[model samples]
Target chain A: MEMKSFLIIGMGSFGHHLCRSLAENECEIMVVDKDSEAVEDVLPLGVSGRVGDCTNIDVLRSFSIDLFDACFVCMGTNFKNSLQIASFLKELGAKKVYAKADEDIQAKFLKRNGADVVIYPEKNVAEQIAIAASSDNIFDCIPFVEDYYIAEIRPMERWLGRTVVDVNFRARYNLNIVAVKQGENVIPIPGPNYVFNEDEHIMVLGHINDIRRVAY
Target chain B: MEMKSFLIIGMGSFGHHLCRSLAENECEIMVVDKDSEAVEDVLPLGVSGRVGDCTNIDVLRSFSIDLFDACFVCMGTNFKNSLQIASFLKELGAKKVYAKADEDIQAKFLKRNGADVVIYPEKNVAEQIAIAASSDNIFDCIPFVEDYYIAEIRPMERWLGRTVVDVNFRARYNLNIVAVKQGENVIPIPGPNYVFNEDEHIMVLGHINDIRRVAY
Candidate 1:
């Protein structure tokens, strides 16, 4: 298979993680960072690492930016350097360019100036933490809509051996059970006759209130 | 402030992670698992541990299910047992119940049986991984529509010194810059004057095709 090529602008924590993930998945990676030590640290990871300023056009041109399938601006701190790199990538005719912005103003500028995608890692992590904190029983919460969510919740003690027909859950809670994950195995949308087990993880979907009610 | 209460039915990897995360946030937790060892393992983590069959009605009633704010039905392997638990929770008038289902049929059954939410862990994780792999520059991708997505892309070299107005990104790429997130900080909906730097993450909204065009 032809491996996809990627250019990562920063070699910070997020960048390092992304690089490792992609590399493990067989993607060809080219990394750039201003810090020589950072580049050296990742050299053995088998990715093409360059110690150079990502904001410099000459440094980018040296790598033949057009050959890359995509570019990831992983710089998470300085807003100015991010924009410069984004503009440079677009002007170079790279197929796609992604940048990380620290502030709303920087994000807007990147978008308006040709950055294809901008990410906010801190907000996403915080939201995940907040959601986990707010609901006591919810193991993991994924939003389906503003009011609706899919959550992994611990089963209440009362639900030990009753069948679906016995509960008439639809009429009462207005929720949906999507699937069940058991250990490494997955049961795709179990049948009505399926019996509940003690070590199973049930996947559910419904309104926040309804889910919270069952979760609590 | 009154802390919320939670009940975790299964003591698997997901359950363990959930319990630890919630407990860290100061939520009260009750853990129920068939394996005595599993319950004992997490006892020191500050969670109430109970070794009992989740499918038992007597066990369900003994937990004072009414007091729990929500419940997580983590049992996914045994569909029959999961269904029983879902119905039991509903019968007990637990405010909300969440389950992890491996199959679509299981989800349907859990929903029909009063489970407020159903989750498919494999499916969710698979989709997340797929998105991350599809785009070289995209570190994260959130789907807003079937054809549209919000992606976080790293900046490229060319865009280092330009402003939003100078680039005219919207007219060129049909992408929206929503926000930027720096390390531990978030700037929502940045404006034109905002500048881009090398070390920032920006949030952009656009169709997948457009996003790909700009990001890569």
Candidate 2:
């Protein structure tokens, strides 16, 4: 398979994690940051590090920025530099550019300045922590729609030997079974012929109220 | 906080993981399985274990089933036993019961037998593995509608300084920025005014075509 190239423009904790994760997956990574220490820290992770201000078009071009399939603008505090970098990356012909914003204003600016996607770390982290604290049975929760979510719930005693068609889940509980997890295996969009067994995880989609009623 | 009690009626690998995870979060766990070895294996995790047939009404009632906030029926095979257990749990006045199904037929049977929810483990696990194998940028992906999905995308350089209103993203890419993740935090339904920054993960909703186009 052809490898995807990624340029990460920050060497903070989050950036380091992303680089390591991507590298583990065998993706080629290029990292840019003004901090020499940060650049050096991630070098052993197989990332090509360039010590330069991300806002400077010359510095970015020096790294052959156009060759990267995607670029991440991860400078959290310096809004101006981050915005300048995003605009330049777009102008330089990068296929996609994602930036991180500290607040709503900064995110809006990034989007207006040509950023393809914007991220807010504070809010995201809080939600994850909250969910983790709220329920022990939830392995993972992903929002599916407005006021609706999909969650991977550890199977409880009452669900064994059940099938999707028999539960009348959609009608009775207003939740939909999207998939099931058994050990390391998964069954997606299972047909009516599927069966329930012990030690399984159910992937369900529905409003929070409906999901809460059934999942617990 | 008041500790919640959960009864997990299987001692398989999935059950073991669930018990450990729940115990780590400080919930009281009770495990029931016909397999003596399975029960013994998870005993060190501090879960209460019983080596008896979970399908037997006498066995279920012996545990004072009403005290449990929820019960998980996790037997994979032996559909008859699974169905009997679900029914018995409900009849004994358990508030909620979840079951695991090895196939669609079993899942249907469990539901009809009074299981509140049924899980298909093979289905959920496969989808998670597939997505994990396919993309490093996306930490997780959940389908919302037939063609639309929500994904947590790792921030890339081109998105810094952007806001929802500034990009007209829904119009431009047919994608919605639903939430943002930064570090270990999550922001649900972030307003349009939210800003993008570095080192943040983004929760986005859009058609698969659009999600693929923007997430990368």
C-alpha lDDT (0 to 100) for residue A84 of candidate 1: 87
What does candidate 1's lDDT look like per residue over B143-194, in tens digits? 4434555577765556666766677766776776655657545454456766
All candidates: DockQ:
0.04, 0.04
Kindly provide the TM-score obtained by chain B of candidate 2 when compared with the true chain B. 0.74
lDDT of 1 by residue, A1-216 (tens): 367888888887567666765676567888889998878877787988888996779888888888987788877667788888899989988888877664457779999986887764433332343365565566666554345555676666666576554556555767666545576454433545556566776656567778877876
Q: TM-score for each prediction?
A: 0.50, 0.48
RMSD (Å) per prediction = 16.8, 16.7
Candidate 2 residue B43 C-alpha distance from true site, Å:
44
Please provide, for model 2 over B41-116, each residue's C-alpha lDDT reduced to its tens digit, 9 standing for 90 to 100: 8789887888998766888889988898778776654678889889999999988887877555777888999798
Q: In candidate 1, residue B211 scores what lDDT?
A: 76
Alpha-carbon lDDT, every model: 0.70, 0.70
lDDT score at residue A109, model 1, on the 0-100 scale: 99
